[model samples]
Target: MRELRIRAGYETLGELHRASGVTVATLSRIESGVQIPSPKTLNRLAPFLKVSVEDLLAAAGYLPEKEEDPNEAAARTIEAAISDDPELLEFWQELVKRDDLQLLFKQVKPLTPKSIKKIIKVIKAIEDAEATED
Candidate 1:
């Protein structure tokens, strides 16, 4: 965390604190390995540091760093793709909540790689369309 922050040009805890809205004490503790950051803190800091929440969580030992199942990886990839797009993500959340989609997902709980790829493609298409519209 400290190395990444320093690489990102945050020379001091105060600079990180101001940019991340995390307290200097908390940043100090985290950098010193005396304390791990909470999810909220990671979320706030990840963007400023140009890192992903999963990467931060893994580095903090909150999430496993090992390779996950393909389905889980696919889900994470999709989430990462949408993380910067609030409108598209909001639409995705609503679409996921639909009964038809929910039932379809239940029927395919352990998603196949091909299906996951297709889902990602569909989402990308939607996001692209939205961007073009904007």
Candidate 2:
């Protein structure tokens, strides 16, 4: 985790703290092996580190590492990418209920992280715009 953060250009704990809002002290403890982050913290940090929460959880030993079905993994990855907040999850779930949206996913069986991030940003921008107009 520490290596990932550093490679992501968060060269110092303070830098990671500023980006993630997870406090330098807590990050310090986690990197030093003195503490393990809870799932929520891992969720908060994963996107900033350009990693998936499942990977982070597996690395932290909170989840077992095992082979996953490619289709299922893609779905989970998309869901995780949109789960930065409750509003995003609500929006994603709504989209999931649409048959047309499911068909789109079938067409793009697998999505890259960059594509997923772009989707997330678009959705978030829409959400923010809606909130302000309300």
Candidate 3:
């Protein structure tokens, strides 16, 4: 929510009211997620919040981004940034998508082709012996 407030240049409820002409109670309720504004209210609030009206759906988890939270908030910031970045598109194309099994692969680069051949040979020997005896 800090991000929204910062973008709107509103540090206080009074600032929100002054900038957008919304009543303090209404703005407070909206910010606190106690009330979901109607479309017209949202349209007025969006410019005041410096966010899109669609971003006001807090009941549906349309959270105003708070950059102070290190984990979830930071993750959302990165996602929003990546979706907007052009250079990141090239980098993403070169890299595989991050997923559960492959997450460690991103931190650890793979071995050379020669080292892979040696590893594959050990696997083949193990398989061949298993097939012959078992």
In the range 72-122, model 3's lDDT, one tens digit per residue, is 333333334455445543443333344652443334344554543454355
Better of 2 and 3 by TM-score: 2
Clashing pairs counted in every model: 0, 0, 0
Model 1: colliding residue pairs: none
Q: If scored against the real structure, what TM-score would every candidate get?
A: 0.48, 0.49, 0.41
For 1-134, candidate 2 gives per-residue lDDT tens digits of 78999888898999989999999899989999999999999999998998899999998998898676665666688887766667767767776666766656666745676678678669678868998999
For candidate 1, what is the TM-score?
0.48
**Candidate 1, poorest ten consecutive residues by summed lDDT:** 101-110
Error of 1 at 49 (Å): 1.2
At residue 65, candidate 2 shows an lDDT of: 83
Worst 10 residues of 2 by lDDT: 101-110
- Candidate 3 segments exceeding 4 Å error: 1-3, 57-134
Candidate 3 residue-wise lDDT at 125 = 65
Q: What shift in Å separates residue 21 of candidate 3 from its native position after superposition?
A: 1.0
Q: After superposition, how far is residue 24 of candidate 1 from its true place, in Å?
A: 0.3
| Most TM-score-accurate candidate | 2
The superposed Cα distance between candidate 1 and the true structure at residue 123, in angstroms, equals: 42
Better structure of 1 and 2 per lDDT? 2
lDDT string for model 1 (1-134, tens) is: 87899888999999988988899999999889898889989999998888899999998889899675654444455556565667656666656545655445434555554555567568668867998999
